[model samples]
Target: MNDLGRIEDLPADYVEEMRKVNLVPLWPSLRGVLPPLKPKPQTRATMWAYADIKPLLLKAGELTPIEKAERRVLVLANPGHGLDKMQASPAMYLGMQLLLPGEWAPSHRHTPNAVRMIVEGEGAYTTVDGEKCPMSRGDLILTPTGLWHEHGHDGTDAVVWLDVLDLPLVYYMEASYHINGERQPIKPDRGDRAYAGGGMVPTPIFERSHKAYPMLRYPWDEARSALLRLGQDRQDLDCIQITYVNPETGNDAENILGFYALMLRPGQTLRLPARSPSCVFHVIEGGADVKIDEQSFALTEADTCCSPGYTPVTLHNRHADKPTFVFMADESPLHRKLGVYEVRN
Candidate 1:
């Protein structure tokens, strides 16, 4: 092109002077580091259909024994992360874990904060330290950082759940540690626990100085009821949102992550433009349309959608009669640390 002739004709001394100052001409550097417009997220929006994955999960259980497998999980790996690792986005890790009846995943602990959103089969449970938290179809169970925990299926059928972890952040900080060994169970107090009706009797034996919440399970029944009540109170038809909080500190459910339950009424929509901290959403019930920039993905029950940090998004419930419900988790720790978390109007 004619523009290229100017560079070829430049005097040698002029180019040498530019090199000596540790500067390159603006053209190349700016294109890579500072683009003309906000770039789309490196990660792509994805969906994992439970119906398709369930049979595969059962087959995996038949092939591998629990002790040898450590954990039998099918990671919802993002295409952007390449094939080397299982990452839902640059900031999160998502997988579906399966356990056969009478099997157990031995107790262990790691630095990454983790959560379990039960996908199917119940009566299976996760024990954090000593508290027994029974798993259900829509429950959100937490296995906070460095806390010894184990999963076992005592139910008649196979148990499966979506396992989410803030591993990317932990690994990024080089704070990763793992104890892939058995842990002794602590006998939980029968009376004093977050699940024990609001009277909250003190259970000193269960207390850890740094621990935020005493409850392991945030039951779906309570969450759904609360959402319904809030929806009735609000005049807006778009969405009713609630966050799981640490009863002690009144903040997010965990120190490193944030959790939300949203209910979008039929024909309503929520437009959330680009902001800091990436988010991954799990559809709890009904169907909705999730738009990421110009691309769109339709999500149904048990499907998941990912949006990397600073990517514009809009969620719509196009169902003619029923409401759509979703559970969302995000990298809140990074957001809080950088002081850049927000929702663009």
Candidate 2:
């Protein structure tokens, strides 16, 4: 590659004139925008232990009340993106949100799509577009763009969940905002029950539902059973994984990000190929070791970590007698939509 001319090489007066006209030279910064080979992502290999986060979260609950805080959260921001930006990757935002007993987070809707992965506690539920979805350990609940959602807790313990959102991308497009709304009346039916079976769906011969999101909540019990069945049936497979999809359309659960559940057999080590989309991993059960580039993270239950794009990752089950399960969120849908998705061995 030839060395491009530096901005300093240009005449000082000419540079000032271009600056005054709101015009700048491209050659000096062309390589930065269009780098050679794969992209130079700012997202780094980072991890956050639940053990370290829980204490501070409980302290936050004691310090602030629900009325003043609205949603009490501690962001899991990536150092590569700068802590102030509150982003895990270029396109994803992660935060650990807490709700104490008898608390209710008011209803509101935002332009960015969001999901909640329940980390601990019980008797907490999220109401989205009217349907009330219960929160349990390992459950995933979706709050798509422009849909009203709120959280409430009935149990006597603290409820915490990992929140994943495409806020950076939506904010970058200048379409990020939220509208507060009054409390919603609970609906009669839930989407998960309507589409529980794998190969079956409501016929809707008389009338079809026009809602964009047919399913709002995915139970952890169902997902774990599916993984166990897959592992039993496919003993030869190295990686036991399942993608969360829209049962009616067989597409990714959400529009912008891909969600998956991965199971590692007892004492198994799985190597995932380098892919174009950055990924976030959260341990749901057991313990595991995650390696990305030169960084390594020992993730136990409720621990979260992220890896950049164009880098292969390795996962190893720390237990020798039992399996390990992990929840993963990635930017594949956005990458594919932009026609740049890739996987390299």
Q: How many clashes does each candidate structure show, in the order listed?
A: 0, 0
Q: Estimate each model's TM-score.
A: 0.84, 0.98
Which ranges in model 2 have alpha carbons more than 4 Å from their true place?
A: 204-209
True-vs-predicted CA distance for residue 38, candidate 2, Å: 1.5
lDDT by residue for model 1 (1-345), tens: 213244446678887899899865665344455554454456776777777788888889889888889899988888877745688877689999998889889999999999999877877988887778888888999999888899988889888899999887788889988997675566754212444454353565545454565667888888888888888888765559888876555578787778889988777789876776778888988888999877788888888888877777899996979878899988876679778676665
Tell me the lDDT of candidate 1: 0.79
Per-residue lDDT tens digits of candidate 2, residues 116-135? 99999999999999999999
Best by TM-score: 2
Report, for every candidate in turn, its global Cα lDDT versus the true structure. Answer: 0.79, 0.95
Question: How many pairs in model 2 have backbone atoms within 3 A of each other, for residues 3 or more apart or on separate chains, i.e. clashes?
Answer: 0
